[model samples]
Target: MPTSIRRRLAPLLLATATIVLAASACSSEPADDGGEQSSPSPSAEPTDEPTTDATDATDAAESGGVCATGDLSFTVTEKSQAGGYYLITASAEPGVTCTLEGRTVEAGFGSGVSGDVKPSEQAEGEPITMTGSIKAYAGVNPHSGPQEGGVQFEEIIVSAHEGDMDPVSLKLPGTAEVDQPIGTNWHTDAAKAVPFSS
Candidate 1:
């Protein structure tokens, strides 16, 4: 082309070349450090890979992680009489799973004159797994035979076995005529559970 045109285009060509070279140098990939790269720094940004915390949680879930107390909700179904005692059905809230091994989340009534609770004849020593809508049973009876009169209780409190577990307070369907209620440890078989003894 003409000399004037060539002079004008020369600067534009040089600028384009510089931009290309700078872009080529800006790679994010870590350069090969002769295979001697040190461990990842604590302050490094997270990558696409799963983090340690995520890995640990996954492993725990796979291995049956212990059920957190806060994640559990306990409820008492309506009370009914069976045999010679009152039966209380304890149920776990939805989406909860827990081990009853060595767990003593038991039921109790008023203190002092009202009397205390004891394990029912049916309380199971083996651990029962509670999950979802699954339920356990406890038997209670305040009045002892013909001589003992039933104690009137307005509310029933389920004691927490672990410090982490929260105790549940339930309003009785009616006055619990308890003399010395015996509560059974939570068990899968409702027949085996009995209320606490005073």
Candidate 2:
């Protein structure tokens, strides 16, 4: 080959080699970045685990367990409205999670079922779950009849359901007039706890 031909081919060959080397280096960088990016993927997966666990916790709250009498603290207050009634608030104990099985509590003025408080609402309500700051509310109207002729009761025996093994005896905030005592279903909202028979 002539010297001029060699000279022209030499520059072309050198340029081609440099382009190949640059291309190889650029390709290698992305592979290293991919390895670095993969390092945090495991931690990201753990972050998603908490979200999944939250869903499981919600499922447990829905169908998990009933609240034992010992798992709650009860407070009875006199509600001035709705022809005078008793507002019962049940609060969950610390770190306790449980559900109220029925819409209304098994409540009575005395020991026998004859004194059992009738439910004002004909249709039972959805079960309410109590946890953390969540609370369940029920309203008891000691006398649904005209206020003139009603017996007096000092305290009410209450339970989460009928025949509950661990029932609670909550004192009335005031002397309640007792006749045909009626109660509302357990609800999250205190306003919905009015024990009106209508």
Candidate 3:
């Protein structure tokens, strides 16, 4: 071949090699799909459920605790037996679980201890847990003394003990003649709660 023809063909061959290399590089590069391609993150996703510890804490707060005066409702039922005593029933409010601390309820017709009824000599029992419809009974013998005359009251104030908060005032089923009013310790059994002064 002639020297001029060889030089022209060499230039064309070099240009063709450059074009092939460029095309290969373009094919090796990744294609863009119009969005970022990255690994999914578990922490980034939103969650609606609470942790187990949190749920347990909420349940404990809703259920067990010491019984405050506000957690109970008191009702006085007049009893014809037992020398005309009043059966003071303490009922736990809705969804409350509370510990009954004292053996007796602090009951009185007046605000002071002078009007407070005394508890009987019955043995103090273990603390009772009042929950859901559970109730405790305390018997109060109005006019327990042999005095001919006594104070008349239509309502009675009741508390778990002295200094307890939110004491409830409950209307008696009927007017009571209170002299030396004596009360028995709170008992789950009505027989034990009878204020039998012996």
Q: Which candidate is the best by TM-score?
A: 3
lDDT by residue (110-132, candidate 2, tens digit) is: 86555678989888888777778
lDDT of 1 by residue, 80-149 (tens): 4543555556555576556654333455676463465654453347665667777665556645545556
- Per model, state how many residue pairs clash: 22, 0, 0
**Residue 40's lDDT in candidate 3:** 39
**Candidate 2 TM-score to native:** 0.66
What is the C-alpha local distance difference test score of each model?
0.59, 0.83, 0.78
Per-residue lDDT of 40-103 in model 3, one digit per residue for the tens? 3656655798778889988886666677888888888888777778898887988778877647
The numbered model that scores best in lDDT is 2
RMSD of each: 11.1, 7.7, 7.3
**lDDT winner, 1 or 2:** 2
Please give each candidate's TM-score: 0.54, 0.66, 0.67
lDDT of 3 at 187: 78
Any runs in candidate 2 off by more than 4 Å, and if so which?
Answer: 1-63
The TM-score ranking, best first, is 3, 2, 1
Model 3 TM-score, 2 decimals: 0.67
